[model samples]
Target: MKKILIAHDGSKSSDKALRKAFELAGKFGSSVTVISVIPELYLTELMDIDRARILETLTGETTRTMEKIKASVKDVRTVRTMIRQGNPASEILDAAKKMKADLIITGSQGRHGAEKFLLGSVSSKLVDYAECSVLVVK
Candidate 1:
């Protein structure tokens, strides 16, 4: 693939997914776009919220996560990072479309059966809506 989009949520599963993307990107000479979606509820729910502080925390965490991904990849030059605020699934798909990505890599929480039926997994919805290929890392 030429362009790859990886969605990371600062979770262990996501870290594995990021590492997998690094491996794939290296093999294919693909440019990797790493995205972290910070749920936007905090922005609206908190009264007199410090936007700068919230963004600082978000970007700082995202940067640290990106660093970990970079460390795992031998060639870091092809990797790019982005932090956004919204629903994770929609943001990921939107970012992929905007980047014209050939594939999307994401981590799964491994929820299934009754739990998945009640909670509704993001990966399942993404698989249905995404225009490009999606890889779910368990």
Candidate 2:
């Protein structure tokens, strides 16, 4: 694989997936792109809150997370980080396609029961829609 795309959400499973992606990238000499998505705030419109402030807070948090990831992968060659605001699955799939990634890796949240049913998993969506091969780390 020449390019690898990893979706990280600051979760333990995502950390594991990031490690796995780094291992594969090392073996294949592939460039890695890590993406963190801030979900669209549908409720913000209804609530009397400052949309820009909320977005600023979320962007700040995502930046901190990405900074940590960058530090961890400092030894790796050609590691890139991105922060996007939108649906996680859509943003990730869009990134994979735009970057022409040969492989897309993501961590499974392992959400089951009603939660999974109500809020469909991002991993599942990526697996179903991504044009490239997907590896879901649990």
Candidate 3:
């Protein structure tokens, strides 16, 4: 692919996906964009102060994750890193569309049983809704 979009959250699964992206980039001379999203709950759920604190903390973590992603793809010539606050699937899809990525890659957590039922997987959601081609790595 000429343009690749990778969704990362600093998890091992995401790390693997990142490595795969780099491999593809190395092979085909593709440009990759890495994105990390911090879930932002509904605004009315918490007081303004509490919301600020949570956002601040998550923002810090987002920064760290983005930095790590940057380091991982440092040798790649056309890699970019970004941080967004929202639902992971939505953010990823939006970014892919914005970047006009030919391929979208993400990691699968493989949450089964009750966990899968309770909290829908981001990868699955993206596969269902994303307009571009997606690769969900294990």
Residues 1-138, candidate 2, lDDT per residue (tens digit)?
899999988777788899999999988899999999988888845554677778889899889989988887844689999999999899999999898999999887732323533423888899899999999875
Candidate 3 whole-model C-alpha lDDT, 0 to 1: 0.82
Query: How many clashes would you count in candidate 2?
Result: 0
Expressed as tens digits, the lDDT of each residue in 85-137 for candidate 1 is 87878998999899999999887753132452342366777788999999987
Error of 3 at 121 (Å): 1.7
Instruction: Give per-model TM-scores.
Output: 0.80, 0.87, 0.86
Alpha-carbon runs more than 4 Å astray in model 2: 44-49, 110-120
The segments of candidate 1 whose C-alpha lies over 4 angstroms from its true place after superposition are: 42-45, 50-55, 110-120
Whole-model alpha-carbon lDDT for candidate 2: 0.85
- Give the candidates in order of TM-score, highest first: 2, 3, 1
**The 10-residue segment with the lowest total lDDT in model 2:** 110-119
Q: Write the per-residue lDDT of candidate 3 for residues 3-30, one digit (tens) a residue.
A: 9999887777788888998988888899
Candidate 3 has its poorest 10 consecutive residues by lDDT at 110-119
lDDT head-to-head 2 vs 3, winner? 2
Candidate 1 residue-pair clash tally: 0
Task: Provide the lDDT at 59 for model 1.
Answer: 75
**Among all candidates shown, the one with the greatest lDDT:** 2
